[model samples]
Target: MRIGILLHALFYALVLWKGSQASPYWMGLLLGSGAGFYWYGYNLLSLRETDTKLRGEFGSWTGMLSSLATMAAPLLSGFLIASVREIGYPLVFSLSLAFFAWAFLISQRLVTNEESELPAPIFCRRHPNWNRVLLGNFFQGIREGVFVFFASIMVVMATGSEWALGKFTAVNALFSTVSFFAVGKLLRWYWYNESMLIGSFVSTGAIALFLFGQNYRTIMLYGIITAIFTPFFLVPFAARVFHVIDEAHERYEREYVVEREIVLNGGRVLSIIAFISTYRFLPREWIATYLLLVGSMQILAVLILRNVGFRLKKSF
Candidate 1:
């Protein structure tokens, strides 16, 4: 985790010093591994601690806190970059260092955890349901990757400034923070499938709105609505994904976590590769096709959830 943050800070600092003229691309390649390490370190540690700390309900506040960071960080970075390049990147990166340091210090306060021997084989070699979840996670990852790839370009084309991208992101996440916690609460009151179904419907609607968002104003409005709706699906989907691990199989907890991370990361990596491959040659007109793919996959994810809920008679 420390190396991850340090590398990220280094990457941004390099970008700031040399601009794109430097091989920021190579720097980015280095940072990618750092990112993987970051994800593995923080998520792995949190997974170990969640049962002890959050009672496996980390998804609730995790979503809200993520939303808060999403809203605040970009806005701050945007303002810094736009009005104060002298202070922008360093300030933003420094804040990141502070956050990482704080998390490290807090973690130091916890008792050191010990590894234990497994009572049974780590994975559910017999169960098909968890495998199905992995398949769904992959498709969901594609949707997310494509959205991010396009949304940044779309915002730039619409409004010509990276600062505007940050502003757009901040606005998009404003209500997302509310919806994150709300969905968490909603999950407490309803079955996972029920909330997931509602979220899927909303995601479909939001994408349809984006299809018509040709102007920056329309795009910003689309961001708002998308924010309002996204967490309905995402928060529940994340919680239910981890919920597949039988709480009774505490010994297998780490294995389940690492396995799920591998599967989901596979999907994310594939989507990024696919996007890069086409992004180099594809014209902007192809965006419509991408959006269609996302909408179709959203429905497919919902279907998988329904299956898990009804057929498995489990987590959902």
Candidate 2:
């Protein structure tokens, strides 16, 4: 994790020094690799530290903090850019590097005595349920890949201002934070499937609001609705994944993490390619249809999990 953060810091430093001369492809490669390392290590550590009983709470707090950061970072960046036009981007990049360095330093204090072992080869056959979990993760990633970038771009296009998009995202984050808090308090082990079902349906349905118009109001409504329900889906989904990891046995946890990442990224790449193809080779009006197709992916994930008969306990 520290190495990942150091790499992230290095990436920022290179961008800060090179500015526009930097190749976007190489910069993205560096950033993506750093993210891969960070998330892999983070997920392993989280699995080691959390159990099924408490995983929901852990996910909730993590989501809440992430939402807070999402809310603050945009507003801060926008303020800095507006206030200092000449040096704004560089300043933001520098601040990001400093924060990464701080995170690296903080990570150094973490003490883990667990011994590492070689994970089974990626192609080795796994339990049926494990494969289903990976499939669910893949579908989840498909929705995320399209929605994360496309939704934000649409908001900016609709509002004709980055500032408006930032405010919109901030409001969405606030709603998500509240939703996470409520889910943390109210969610129970037996409710996981039901929560995911409701969240998936509502979130998927919210995408239809775009059919009304691609204006700011419709987009904002969509964002708010998705934000409020996403936690309901995501928190349970995460807990269920970890629960499956536990079922697979402690030794295979690392293997499952690697497999999960690969499958998730594969889905993301496929979705992005599909989106690009649709945009380039199809009519503009087809975009909404594409969004609707991808938006329903969460329901697919829920159905996959349901088919696998995920263990639901009466008590946590």
Candidate 3:
């Protein structure tokens, strides 16, 4: 985790120093590799730190905190960019570097007493449930790959202002934070299947509203609906994944994490390629169609989870 944050800080430092001359491909590589390392370590720690009984609550708090950060960072960056045009981007990058540095320092205090074990080879055959969990993660990633970027871009296009996009994102984050809080209080182990089912249907169904119109109002409404329900899907799904990990041998936990990342990224890459491929053959006005198609992929994830049964032999 420290190494990952250090790499992130390095990326921002380079951006601040080089400005436009900084190679985007290199920057992307740095950021991508940093995220890969960060998430791998983060997931491992999450599994190690929390047990099955508290996993859902842990996930909710994680989501809530992340949403809070999401809500604040964009608004602050937008305000700076609008007010301090001369050095706005540099300031943002510098602040990001500072934050990453702080995170790295904080990570140093995280001590693990467990002995290190070598990870099993990537994608090694595992329990049937473990493979199903991987498939579910892949389908979830497919939806995320397109929606993460496309929805925000559509909002910017509709409103024709970065400030509006930031406000839109903040609003969504506010809703998400509230939803996460509610999930934390209300979620139970037995409710996993029901929560995911409801979340998947409502969030995906919200995309159909975009088909009616791709304007700011529709986009905002879609964002709000999805935001409120997404935690319902995400918190349980994450907890369930951890539960599956718990069922496996301790030595293979790191290996499972690597396999999950690989399949998730593969799904994301496949989704993006599909989007680009369709763009060449489809009309430009079919933006909503593309979103709907990708967003619906979450339904597949929910189905896979349901088919495998979200319950374990020893219930939390």
RMSD of each: 3.9, 1.5, 1.6
TM-score to native of every candidate shown: 0.82, 0.96, 0.95
Q: Residues 136-200, candidate 1, lDDT per residue (tens digit)?
A: 87677767766765666788898888799998988877788888777666555246666777777
Give the residue spans of candidate 2 off by over 4 A: 114-116, 309-315
Model 2 lDDT per residue over 1-316, tens place: 7777877998999999899998898788888889889999999999999987899999999999999999998888877877888998899999999999889989988996666676678747568888899999899889988998887899878777767877888899999999999999999877888999999999999998877789888888999999999999999898888888888777778888888999999989899999999999999888888889998998999999866655657664
CA-RMSD of model 3: 1.6
Pairs that collide, model 3: none
Model 3, 28-127: lDDT tens per residue? 9889889899998999899999988888999999999999999999899988887898999999999999999999989989995565665567777668
lDDT of each: 0.68, 0.88, 0.88
What pairs collide in candidate 1? Answer: none
lDDT of 1: 0.68
Q: Residue 243 of candidate 2: its Cα lDDT?
A: 84
Decoy 2 TM-score against native: 0.96
